[model samples]
Target chain A: MQWSHNMRFFQSYAMKKQLWIIVVIIIAAILPTIIGAFWINVAVEILIMGLFAVSFNMIFGYMGQLSFGHAAFYGVGAYTVGLLMAKLSIPFSLSLIAAMLSAGAFALIIGYFCIRLTGIYFAILTLSFGQLIYYIVFEWYSFTGGDNGLQGIAAPHLLSSVTAYYYFTLVIVIAALIVMWYISRSPFGYTMRAIRDNANRTRFLGINVKRYMLINFVIAGAFAGLAGGLWGPFNQSISPDLLNWTESGIPVFMTVIGGSASFLGPMVGSIIYTFLNAFVTGFTQYWPLIIGIVIMLIILFSPGGIQGLIDKWYKHSDSSDENIEL
Target chain B: METGGRNSGSKSEREEITGESMDFSLIFSQFLSGLSRGAMLFLIASGLSLIFGVMNILNFAHAALWLVGAYLAYTFWNLLQPYGFSLWVSIPLAAVALSAIGWAIERVLIRRIYNRTLSEQLVFTFAMILVIDNLIKIIWGVQDKAIVRPSIVASPVFIFGAPLDSYFIFVIFTGAVVAIGLWWFLSKTKYGHIIKAAVFSREMVSALGIPVPKIYTWVFVLGIFLAGLAGGVQAPIGSITLGMDNAVIIQAFIVVVIGGFGSLLGTLVGSIIVGEIYAFSILFWPDGAMILIFVVAAIMLIIRPWGLFGTPMRT
Candidate 1:
């Protein structure tokens, strides 16, 4: 009887979450129509970057390992698509798949070694590996275009317009988010949380800790690649900068800004970050300084980020309601 | 004559790939170049290692600060350009100025994050890099700044048929003095022992009534001072420009990792290894130098995460 009651409670909570998402989707679908072309471009960027940040949070928030080189996978994904379409004349859809696959493959190799150590060592190893890839891409002028970057990557006729690209990104991003949401709610996700909370105990329970972490890392990398795949055609080009360490910091900034504890925190972070980037750069070139000051304030005053702040407010209101009822 | 003949015989084999004859003079020159390169790296990495070793904060903004030091040195030298001793005077002055700035940063920003999660600390410092870099651009403008070297160290010096820039000798000399000075401070001085103790267990040091926060501030200041000195030393070697810190910070990180975090001797040794690898690799594989360094760093990280001289502490 108690189990049944708990199940009902969970079901209603899930229903509320689903309803909220539906409302959000409706708003997103209408956003391009209401906003100007410039804002529409910004929205597309927000969606792609949001997806990237969400993928990053899989390893960061769930698995509790900071992969500083995550941008390597993203870069690989972009390069895969860029090369496929530009060189082999592959279809956009097929190139994206290739991007995901290539990014995952790279992740498997890199993550295999990275999962051996935890904390700062993991971060450094990932960074070194990322730099390794960056140099390869940077120096291979004949193949990867070196510092010149790959140009003339046009999207399909259907997604050539900014509005069309925004819709396409919205659909793909929604699907990716749904898939990730299910993964986060699955038993595998719980197992990751267990490992994060207490790796020793998780091992004692006869789980393969390293294997699970590696799998998580690969999944995150693949998703980041998916986001990267979207980037090349959207921007009409790709560069070696996509895989640079500075690019890796983008998702990190988003995750920290949004709140790493919540599943959708990074997405929220991407929205605020990308939107502000678009808005701020319109006026001044000191975007980095401004963002730096904002991040500093956020870290100093509210380490939990925007989601954490909202959750606190919600809980505070809930307590007041209980007080009134009593 | 026999050695020369043997070298000539092998030169044809090497020349096909490298396009340069492998001779005693070439090898000796490369070795000296590597030594000077290693010394510069040592100057930068030692402070970075010390800060991370004691404070448990891996500062991402370190190279940016180092860049700031270089810019400050330029400004100082520019002011004193009329004097012959300008370059010599500016280097120490820049380091002292940087120490003051370091102390302010520690008290204001770093002190708050002492107990935060590792990611938070890393992100904070990363953000600092962005802010600091931009500030550098605003203050110094986007143009590259070059310092003219004094006559004393203006020309190339020949050692055993190898020509080296005279300023590099000064850089090497400064590196050695700083390395020795740091070793003495860490090993022989009372505060150095306190710092060593703090690295092992901060709580215990604090429990013993030693001001851990004060130690942290001073250590940070000292580290920044070294960075400043390095920057001042580096300014004349090449033109100081925007985005120079980006490449250097990563290289320094590699140096610290290869040496083992918090190990002074390891940093020195690792710097030399990297320096030699970088200098020599340019001969055989010019394009692959950076790639080779990264590969070596990755291998070191995989095989011995604790590094050569560092003992494994917390996971």
Candidate 2:
């Protein structure tokens, strides 16, 4: 009887989750109609950055490692698409694939060196390697256009309209998120959680901890690159700054703000962060100061972030009337 | 010592281009420049090492604080410009000011997050950087501030026929004095011993009635004080500009990593190696200099994650 009661509770929970997802998607579909062109652009950014932050959470949330150089992969992805589209006149779809492949390749190399250590050492190594890539891109004037950055990256005619681009990004991001969601639910995902919770114990259980970490790292990099690839045609330009340490901090901020424990936390964080960025910059130039204070508050008072807050309230409401006696 | 190497500037340039027939004096000058660079790094990184070593809190705001120090030094120097020893007075004053700020930060913010996760601690400090940097913008504006050197060290000094920047001598002297001073304090003082014990086990030290939080506050202040001093010393070397801390902070992190965390001798050696590497690489491969330093640091991290002088027990 108790088991059945628990099963009913979980079933309702899952149904509610699916219902919420559908509602969000429907809202997203009609968003361009309701909002202005300016907001449409911001929505596009929210999707792209949301995808980036989620991928970063693959390391931070699931794998339990902090990668300060995640932007390197993002930057590489952007540069790949920017160069391919602008220089070779490659189709946008092909360019994005190339971006993912190239970013994955770089991650494979950088991650091989990075996965050897954990904790602060991991963060520092990734940062150094990221800077190495940044310097190369910054200095290689002939190929990368140096500090001038690559300009004139126009989207294809089909995506030329802001609304069309928004829809396109929506489709791609939703597909990516679904794939990541499945991965997070799979046995492989459970293994990652095990490794995160206890690496030594997981090793004793015959799981290859390092190999799993490296694979997760590469997957995260590829998705971040995909997000980066989308950015070039949308923004119409790409700079070395995209791959910088500061840029890497963006996804981290989003992940923290949204709540790392929940899968969709980063997306929610992206909504709040990107919207606030668009709104705040309109009036004041002290956006950094504002964001800094917000992050500090989140860390100090609500370390679990907005999602954590919601989860707490949710459990509170559920347990009040439906307390099960075990 | 051949006078020919000194006279023929074009010849040396040609030699540099061709990568052949390098003069001894040119190498000596590079070495001296490297030494000065190392000294500057030491001034910034030693404090970082100390804070991380004792508190286990990697202060991402260390560089930002250093930048603040530079701006403070400029402000003090500007106010005391009529005085002959204005630069000297301003440097220490800047350091003292930074110490006060550090104390406030420790009491209000850092003290709250002593038990938070590593990522939380990192995020907190990182946020501090953003707050501090923007505050600086609001206060100092965007314009670059340059300090004029006093007549005492205004001109280049001949060091073994190399025209070394005279102010660099002062920088090197200050670095050595601080390093020796830090070494002595850590080894010789009662508070220093308590701080070391806290690093090993904060609970044990607290159990012994040492007030570990007080030590943490002072250590943080001490770290920021060094950063401020480094900034003041750096003021006369070039224009104090916004975002200078961005580059220095990364390099300082590299120095701390290369030097074992918590080891004074290690930080010294690491700073010199980095300083020299940067100096020589700029001579041969200007574009690759920063890249090479990063490569070395990555290699060190891979092989010795704790660093050369750091114990594996910390890891």
Q: Which of the numbered candidates is closest to the native, going by highest TM-score? A: 2
Off by over 4 Å in 2: A1-14, A317-326, B1-22
Question: What would the TM-scores of all predictions be?
Answer: 0.93, 0.94
Please tell me which predicted candidate would have the highest DockQ against the true structure. Answer: 1
Candidate 1 residue pairs in backbone clash: none
lDDT of 1 by residue, A1-326 (tens): 97787567556655765687788889999998799999999999999999999999999988888889999999999999999999999999999989989999999999999999999999999999999999999999999999888999999998999999999999899898888878887888888988888899999999999999999999999999999999999999999999999999999999999988888889999999999999999999999999998898999998878877765554432222110100
Candidate 2 displacement at residue A81 in angstroms: 0.5
C-alpha lDDT of residue A207 in model 1: 99
Residue A187 in candidate 2 has what lDDT? 87
Q: What lDDT tens digits, residue by residue, belong to model 2 across residues B68-182? A: 9999999999999999989999999999998999999999998898888888888889989999999999999999999999887887664445567878879889999999999
For model 1, give the RMSD to the true fold. 5.2
